[model samples]
Target: MARPQYILQPVNPYFIAFSLAAAFLLNLLPWGKLPGIPDFVALVLLFWNIHQPRKVGMGIAFFLGLLMDVHNASLLGEHALAYTLLSYGAITIHRRVLWMSLGVQAFAVMPVLVGTQLVPFVTRLLMGASFPGWDYLVSGFVAAVLWPIASVVLLLPQRRPVDPDDTRPI
Candidate 1:
């Protein structure tokens, strides 16, 4: 028997909204002074890029990044640029990264996540703002560390195979 085809379908708008809301919630979580915790937004973008690249692409990432800029009261477009670039990079590497084991993906994604954060950090510095300190990169580190966990959680909904014999037609 041939293996089942995994067709790429558009995710429900509700799901996209819920995922963004959850990411914002995670970002707002009061984790004071935690080091190396991955940024929730980056982790979510990575998960979506690997699993549903067709549905959540750079446009969505850029929009979400813009929202973060507004919510966090930061310079406009700082996160927008970072997210756009990161999402592009993730999508470009999605095929290879998706085939790897979770640990490998996590390790591979670290630099992308860090670079996303670092771009904004450096941009702010060039604008004459004092450094936000080394701790500013903590979110990127956290995002990398949380990669495995995020992947597991995001994949949970897809674990159960849909019954082919059901009334629904393919």
Candidate 2:
């Protein structure tokens, strides 16, 4: 029996930049202040970091996080710290994680999402800020749930074109 062949597509840097920008803009929307809306910027960042480690990494995540912190009017380094950690986690297990099914991928990324959420929570707690309650966790859950969809959507551009002549790929 012939094994399945995976066609690898070349990723365009512009597409990545555009998606991250869109995610940042989405994060700027008021929906994030709601109970269940996940951090869109973090989500997009993780997606790219996992699938395109060479293209997206801690530096990009940190910069975006700083932008988010400024936009959110929160402590300057809070989001930067969280996103940097998240990016590190994503890149750490990206190869292993992407080989699994979407459901498994969702579960695999929980640690990264937790880190992203936990940093801000811990920072606020240490700063004597009031507890945000369990509702804050809802965003992580929501990001997990959205993983499959985000994965599929973001992968669209990475789908390789069919090669008519090549029946079996080495």
Candidate 3:
């Protein structure tokens, strides 16, 4: 049998806002400083970038990045630059990504996710901050691991009903 295809409904803007806000709030939690804690906002932003590029563009990523900079008390544009580039990369490959299996998709996004972490990391190093060690890059991989889960959860709102009537054998 062929794999089932889903025709998702149009995404609601309000749901998008709520997911972004929730991700930011999750980032605000204290556990965020720990290594391997995925960047929830980055994950959410990338999800929307892939699935709804027109709806969530680089502007929103930049804004969230700025907010993160303020919250982390780091270089003002560090995260802004990283997130904006992440958004750009996601949007660029969104079409190709949509066709992949969840496992393949995770690998596809790994580079983008890791690069998002690298931007801030290299920025800090250039500014003379001490090395944070390789662990600093762990979150990116963690975020990639969460990609499949994030895809499922975020797409929940748009998933069409599986129920089929005789006239519509979906």
Candidate 4:
């Protein structure tokens, strides 16, 4: 399958940190609880977890989750638990994910994305919060839809230049 580009160099740790911070900032924007607004943090976390598990592991996921929890001011560990689980799922399948085409990769990771949302949803319900309806899952689907875009953007820094000769790649 054709990829956006192959990585020719090691991914920089700083870029990973920047991407996570940017995603968190995106989440901080006042969307006023829109049902379909995707969770930018979760999306980016999953991307990095899958693509660079060593650099962005569950610890970072938990830390970011804590920040999210504080910002949302919901139950203390909701986002942390969710993001950790998401990271675990991604890391487990990272190798397989890298081989698949972007479109298939999105579908492959859909469950992890949606399940990440599920953690907080279930927690809220267990604590007597009202059912948020099925729209809660919409963001996961949206994130999956954006999978290809995220992969391309995140991989840009690590991409190799294509060879001038058509026979050789990267």
Compared with the true structure, model 4 gives a TM-score of 0.91
Summarize candidate 4's per-residue lDDT along 15-65 as a digit string, tens digits.
988999999999999999788888999999999998888888999999999
Q: What tens digits encode model 3's per-residue C-alpha lDDT throughout 84-147?
A: 9999999999999999999999999999999999999999999999999999999999999999
lDDT of 1 by residue, 30-115 (tens): 77766665668877887788777888899999988998899778999998999988999898888988777778898888888998
What is the Cα-based lDDT of residue 79 in candidate 3? 96
TM-score of each: 0.82, 0.90, 0.95, 0.91
lDDT of 1 at 11: 58
Q: Is candidate 1 or candidate 2 better by lDDT?
A: 2
lDDT of 2 by residue, 1-170 (tens): 84465566888899999999999988877774578788888899999999999889999999998999899899999999999999999999999997888899999987788679889999999999999997897788789889999998988877756564576543
The worst-scoring run of ten residues by lDDT in candidate 2 lies at: 161-170
lDDT of 4: 0.91
TM-score of 2: 0.90
- Residue 130, candidate 2: Cα error in Å is 1.0
- Collision count of model 1: 7
**56 Cα displacement, candidate 1 (Å):** 0.3
